[model samples]
Target: MAEEKESAEAMISEIHKQITDAFDVFDHEFNKTVDVREVGTIIRSLSCCPSEGELHDLLAEIEEEEPTGYIRFEKFLPTMTKVLMERRYRPIPEDVLLQAFEVLDQEKKGHLEPEELTKYMSEEGEPFTQEEMEEMLSAAVDPDKNVILYKDYVGMMTVEDN
Candidate 1:
């Protein structure tokens, strides 16, 4: 139980670090501050999918306290930590991922060649950026077979082996 608590703390620390890094990118003047208007973009860049209303509410809270129209890192961290701890933004489910893969696996072969998967990922709805495609393909593709074992990919996506 102690170990679990420590692990959770470590995970939260990492999340905070990621948020800080994302926030820093928008802090162009090296002031550790950003315009309140950029808060939603910063949050989304951290991959926290808050609804429009939820984001508006969060911004409203920030704006109320930060009448200066800017937010500092100290203020940003706690708010983001609470949002993350709530798990309001969750990963996609395994079944949904598998069904999406099934659509791409036209012949039902349970796998797809790297080229095939790349084509679909790049050409389909909400096309992945090059870096996103590379990151995903690196994990999903099997060099030995030269194919994406999509079921395994889905497991990697949905399961936390750690």
Candidate 2:
């Protein structure tokens, strides 16, 4: 039991370090604080996949606490740590991602053209915003082919199980 507790603590310590490092990059003023407006960027940089609504809610909560429009590291740490530990930002499973791509690959081509991806991502249910679509395409698209090799994209979206 103690061993489990210690391991969990170690994992949390590592997460905290990563979050702090990410936060530091945006805390340019050396005040251990960041502008409220930059919180989304910072969170994304940390690889926490909160939905747009979830992010908005989180920012609303932060604004309620730090009305000065700046967030101190101390204030950010625990909340972020909780979100991380709870796996609220867990990556999508590989199989699920693959299935989504399969649906998009209606012609059974094992790939999708950039324009096709853009249309679906922008027009489908729970559509991605332009910035979100661009970010995804930047990582998932093969510039040479002008296509998304969906298997490769799924690999990028999911972490390998140890």
Candidate 3:
């Protein structure tokens, strides 16, 4: 039985490897055909996410792509998904409070919803209270919540701010 289990694991790994190889080829080729603006958004999304799953889902939602088929970056997701996927707590950007808030505002709106603001923290199954979410959203308490103008969105994540 142990031998059987080992063999099964080996087969699964091999299959996964093949799938990943193929996905890279497809992603590369398809990227060449996408519009510059679209590509820019996708790249921007990836810059914020720890994994590709978050990138994929958010991009898919933005583009209205059906997420049911072909989640290539199944293991790689954003901060929220990563928390749930790994089942552990990880420290996020601490000192760079302003930049963290800006990126969390995927839509570039004035402020983030409590749920959106807290998703990354709660992604590991740690739900946030209304007060916690409000704290994160209040610019007076945390300057990160200050509304980011469209002009400010482009350079929000640079280390130069530090």
Candidate 4:
């Protein structure tokens, strides 16, 4: 079950990335004004990864005329920490994710911004596509934002748990 969920999330993240990339082509760096064809080509991106910030960032970028490159977070990240801590999947120290959340949250408000979430995303932009980006996030970006919280820094977490 966990594996399947992770796989799906990953798929979604991949699709989301693609969409963001397409958005960037015309919005971020382009000479001509925005067009519908460019926009139409990006709907296919899915959200396989669990990074809510990325989705928010992409959506915000689309909404704005200027390039923001990121989005703000709500109360979801700390929430994801809790979900990830649930032992049903495979319990871990929880501290690792919590610590990460703290650093990312910065303000200690239990939320993260889109730029903060980028650390978890893949740095390599190879094989980029809206569909592909969506696929990666489905597993990576927990939309509910309840994975890790309320603990010190942990050394590691089982892949199965993640």
Top candidate when judged by lDDT against the true structure: 2
Model 1 segments more than 4 A misplaced? 1-71, 159-162
Error of 2 at 41 (Å): 2.8
Number of clashes in model 4? 71
Write out the backbone clash pairs for model 3. Answer: 51-77, 52-76, 53-76, 54-77
TM-score of each: 0.55, 0.81, 0.22, 0.24
Candidate ranking under TM-score, highest first, comes to 2, 1, 4, 3
Give candidate 3 regions above 4 Å deviation: 29-72, 75-162
Q: Which structure is stronger by lDDT: 1 or 3? A: 1
Q: What's the true lDDT of residue 82 in model 3? A: 37
Number of the candidate with higher TM-score, 2 or 3: 2
Per-residue lDDT tens digits for candidate 1, residues 35-134, read 8889988987766766657788887765645378788778788888887777665556789889999998999999999889889879976677899889
Sorted on lDDT, highest at the top, how do the candidates line up? 2, 1, 3, 4
lDDT for 55 (candidate 1): 81
Locate the minimum summed-lDDT window of 10 residues in model 3.
153-162
Per-candidate clashes come to 0, 0, 4, 71
Identify the candidate with maximal TM-score. Answer: 2
Task: Estimate candidate 4's RMSD in Å.
Answer: 17.4
Q: What are the per-residue Cα lDDT tens digits for candidate 2 across 29-107? A: 9999999889988987777767778988887765645388888888788888888878776666789889988998899
- As a TM-score, model 4 comes out at 0.24
Q: Evaluate model 2: give its lDDT.
A: 0.85
In the order shown, the candidates' Cα RMSDs to the true structure are 6.9, 2.6, 16.2, 17.4
